[model samples]
Target: MSQETEPEPSPGPKQENGPTTTGSFLCLHTSPPLHIALHGMSALTHTRLSRTAFDLCLELLEAGVKPQALADIVVHILEFKEQFN
Candidate 1:
């Protein structure tokens, strides 16, 4: 008699490091400019602001923002925001 094979484990849902959908939506409406500014500053400053942005992004992600959407919004805001220009 042949031995029975075991079933493979199913994969779990994917998890993101930052910005949940709800958080991103709130962030988009509440302070899109500020969000974009921070993301920009983080890139320019390359130190404190960057870390802060990363932390905030993580918080937003945990709250529910999609990574791609959050990144797009951040880039859009950063490009147009006067301070960065």
Candidate 2:
């Protein structure tokens, strides 16, 4: 019997400047990014979460996770919340 395996997802088309396109900059900054919102919590919590979120953002960007993709995921989560709540 042959085993079937799922293919790894592609990161869309190649941009001239890699994944850090102008659109990505806008998506990550023009609107308050998730890490920025972490400031609303208590000072201690904010410091920890913000630092962690910032590190995760750097890791994601390094891993080729586009800012627009992150934005899309946030939208999907919001939609899910709206539908359920």
User: Where is model 1 more than 4 Å wrong at Cα?
Assistant: 1-49, 82-84
Error of 1 at 53 (Å): 1.8
lDDT digits (tens) for residues 1-85 of candidate 1:
9999999988889876444356335444345575678667767865433456686775676577787897887777666774665
Error of 2 at 44 (Å): 18
The numbered model that scores best in TM-score is 1
**Per-residue C-alpha lDDT of model 2 across residues 2-74, encoded as one tens digit per residue:** 9999999989996553233343332333335443553344244533334555556545764568878975775
The global Cα lDDT (0 to 1) of model 1 is 0.64
lDDT of each: 0.64, 0.54
TM-score against native, each model: 0.37, 0.31
List pairs with backbone clashes in candidate 1.
18-61, 19-60, 19-61, 19-65, 20-60, 20-61, 20-64, 20-65, 21-64, 21-65
Question: Lowest summed-lDDT stretch of 10 residues in model 1?
Answer: 20-29
RMSD of 2: 16.1
For every candidate, C-alpha RMSD to the true structure in Å = 10.4, 16.1
**Cα deviation of 2, candidate 1, in Å:** 26
